[model samples]
Target: MDQVTAAFDATPRRDFLPRAVRRRASYDGPLGIAAGQTNSQPRTVDDMLRLLDVRAGQRVLDVGAGSGWTTALLAHLVGPAGSVLGVELEPELVSFGSGNLARTDRPWASIRQAEPGVLGDADGAPYDRILVSAMADALPVALVDQLADDGVLVVPVDGTMLRVTNPGAVVTAHGRYRFVPLR
Candidate 1:
């Protein structure tokens, strides 16, 4: 398997899921967690990671990190040299995701609560890669501005998945995908 797939395989999904739905951890479908948030499907996560092309020593931003699954996976890909910051709007989910990520022993990855309507971490601006799990009505300008010179951002806009590149100058649509709207 490729590196991304290998990372997915190595990271235990069960660890990131809520106890009640732990049994379906490997189901490959989205499962609801608390606060009306749902983990993205495994396939969708994989696809987005592939598009992001994350690499070791490359800092990444994970927007709408529900259960910290994507955050942990990105941590694995980025290794110790890189860092990952996950932003969630829900306070409970921020705690939940932080707790889940703590188990991974990856100090480089962390989850934090974001203010309502905030797109990305401005304080942690200029991310090498950014992955948005939730769908936005349109491209979030703030997030686009946060990308590094050659950064890549994979986000769901309208009903399609878009891979935005560098300074947010280019946008390529991947395909249709359903996701919870970004709050």
Candidate 2:
């Protein structure tokens, strides 16, 4: 089985969700989380992760980290040698997500409140992989610049799931996907 799939089995989705929706964790559709955000459908997240091709020791950035589900999964994928930084916009979710992440005892992964009017964590640039759960109207040049020389980013842009590699910033569309607009 693929590493992403293995990660899914290792990290229970219900652990990262709000109590009200924990029973619905196995549902294929997206579930509501704090601050009107969705945790994203499992299938979509799996697709994004497979496209990203995250390695065991690559540093990853998870934009729109929502409930820190993806962050914890990324931490599992990277193992102890890597780290993951998840940034979320809503303060409520920030606190909620932070607490969820803490339960996993994965010190290498953390969710932080996103800065006002800022995109990803700029200070932690040069990420080996970036996964954006929100949708953008167009390619976010700012995020592409955050990539390391050979980094990869999986994002939803204009309804299309795009796998973008650094260097030339090559982009390939996977399929159509719906997501909350990027703030």
Candidate 3:
């Protein structure tokens, strides 16, 4: 439970979650968010965040942000000097997530609905880290190119593989991660 405690201390998962979901947040089961998608459980979130190796003062792009739970966590991880841009495909869902973020005291969190599979606001290019919450059959080349030269991109590929891409490097691993498929 150390990881879970760390995440909760850094960012209250319940704060990013919808009121309805706050009641069900756990590491054992999937929790639904807006747009018919679900937030991976607490343990999953911890694992993914660990894999991303996010640090303070690093700009992060949260692709397929559901209720902005992970985005909020990134905001906390990056602190006030850094920013997190949450891009989702459904406008209403984006609005919902944005609203959730707006209620937070954190100042570096923001959300936008965009064409699916896109990353970072074009205006906010070259993020230090990119975390795609949803899985895809293949890595989205666009996201890799959006990364800063030394940036990291963590994506779940082929629905069962986790791939981390960086300049001159690409790594993949097989795993059972339950996430809404990236569109």
All models: lDDT? 0.92, 0.93, 0.77
Pairwise lDDT winner, candidates 2 and 3: 2
Report lDDT (Cα) of residue 4, candidate 2.
89
lDDT of 3 at 66: 76
Summarize candidate 2's per-residue lDDT along 22-108 as a digit string, tens digits.
999999989999777999999999988999999999899999989889999999999989999999999998898899999988899
> In terms of TM-score, which candidate is strongest?
2
Please give, for residues 123-151, the per-residue lDDT of candidate 3 as tens digits: 67788888888877777777777888788
Steric overlap count per candidate: 0, 0, 0
Off by over 4 Å in 2: none
Q: Least accurate stretch of 10 residues (summed lDDT) in model 3?
A: 1-10
Alpha-carbon lDDT of model 3: 0.77
Positional deviation of 169 in candidate 1, in angstroms?
Answer: 1.7
lDDT of 1 at 21: 95
Rank ordering of all candidates by TM-score, starting from the highest: 2, 1, 3
Question: Number of clashes in model 1?
Answer: 0
| C-alpha TM-scores of all predictions | 0.97, 0.98, 0.88
Q: What is candidate 1's CA lDDT for residue 9? A: 83
Candidate 3 vs. true structure, TM-score? 0.88
